[model samples]
Target: MNGSIKWINGSATLSPIKFIAKIDNRLYDLNHFDRDDFNEEVLELDNLELALNLSVSLYTPISFLELSNIAKIVDDNNLDYKKVDIFALRDIRTDKNFNTILNINNFPESIRKYLTLKTLPLKSIELITTFSKSLQDFLNGFFISNISISYQKAKIFIDNIAIQKEALEGVKYIDGFEFADRKTSTHIEIDNALIAINSKIFPMSISTDDNFESGKLKISFYVDKVNSYDKFIDILNSNDKDIRTLIEFLKGHDLGL
Candidate 1:
């Protein structure tokens, strides 16, 4: 989770906040937690009330001067302004000044659980897409971990495969042995399975992580083909039908496509 969205004051309608010598103490009380856990089995997202205290910072020439030369910039108007981008002296950063809560409405069940609940990774895709848009709009910028492709192996972990094993019970393989006719552990759940989902817009492969217990079902997007955040959001919001599905998924009530 190490990325920041850089935003600047472009619209005149958006007023630039004035520099504050001291910040309010109430801002310190609010916690900055994006994910919340209820024991090991149950997981949920925090900030339902959405009391996010965003700190403010403004880069200026005055904040970049040293204490000994503070009066020089204020008294002399001929000073070079190119150094405005560099902070040579005192820090002008402020603490969290205020909090804001957006109207995300009521979502059923824990979002944390639903995302990795053994789907084709579509739920997690929608979650990240919508989350990025909301956070980018709320704060001038937002930050999160980067999700990239891992091509070390084609297949990852898989749990119970009774359903799949049954479906392909009598299926023949390239070698000659049948699915049920195998005398030894075939390890079909790990090496081979029809779980990878291919799409024209975004090609993705979902599998369970080997770290977690085999009994506890989980979803891992370790080998995601989507490269960038903007690209992932674009893939999900490419059409009106997908957009509606994302909205319903966020509400945690949709049956899914």
Candidate 2:
């Protein structure tokens, strides 16, 4: 449970609201059934479903739920879940264009650039862990991409994350291979990163952003910036030579409940 858990053989996505409601109902039932068993809040569950839906509805097109299913597998199976999480990792970009990033139409022109990682189906929860680390590492390091940055206000200063400075001399995860002419670090991978915002956390992933990037880690927390199911798994194994597998956790393994 502490190490990597490869749950899916291919990519999949879950409805966040359903997930939230499911877990919420699960937690409520857990307490309701055991109210007489323990009076000390034996299982702590946070009701962030309504709040998140408020925040989420502002962004994506969410469907109306006819009803929310109650979760019982964990309780029924007697699984000990210390935490349950709601996570989101979003890359809020005004533009959605990757034509400049990688020219799939003409590979020959980009051949001079170091070849990027193969799109391996995720092997583990790396979708959440690895991707997040990569994004953090990328910004922390002096990495480059085909795209350039331009600000309406060039004078704007960044309140950057603190770094040891000395660590910069060492190689970073996103630091690409060194060529005779220069070094290359293409693509920003935010694989399997656990992200937290206040009491909420999630993987938004490639597990590579696999923040579950969209589901729960342990009832624990994680995140990646990108959103949506199809995109999540695509990025995770997008690097591994083995071809990445599994986008989100399989429902069959959700707490074994």
For residues 1-257, what per-residue lDDT tens digits would candidate 2 score against the true structure? 11111111122233222221233444332212222332333233354343233323433321111000101221233332222111122211111111111122122222111112221111211111222333334332422342232321111111111222233234353435321222222111212222212112124322222423355433322334545655545544353332222212233334121
RMSD of 1: 25.7
Superposed model 2: Cα runs more than 4 Å off = 1-46, 60-128, 131-139, 143-169, 172-257
Q: Write the per-residue lDDT of candidate 1 for residues 158-231, one digit (tens) a residue.
A: 11122233443333323222234332333343223223122323343333355224432232223346476665
Q: What are the runs in model 1 whose C-alpha is more than 4 Å off?
A: 1-175, 181-201, 211-226, 237-257
TM-score of each: 0.17, 0.17
lDDT of each: 0.25, 0.25
So what's the TM-score on candidate 1? 0.17
Cα error, residue 65 of model 2, in Å, equals 26
Summing lDDT over every window of 10 consecutive residues in candidate 2, give the lowest-scoring window.
62-71
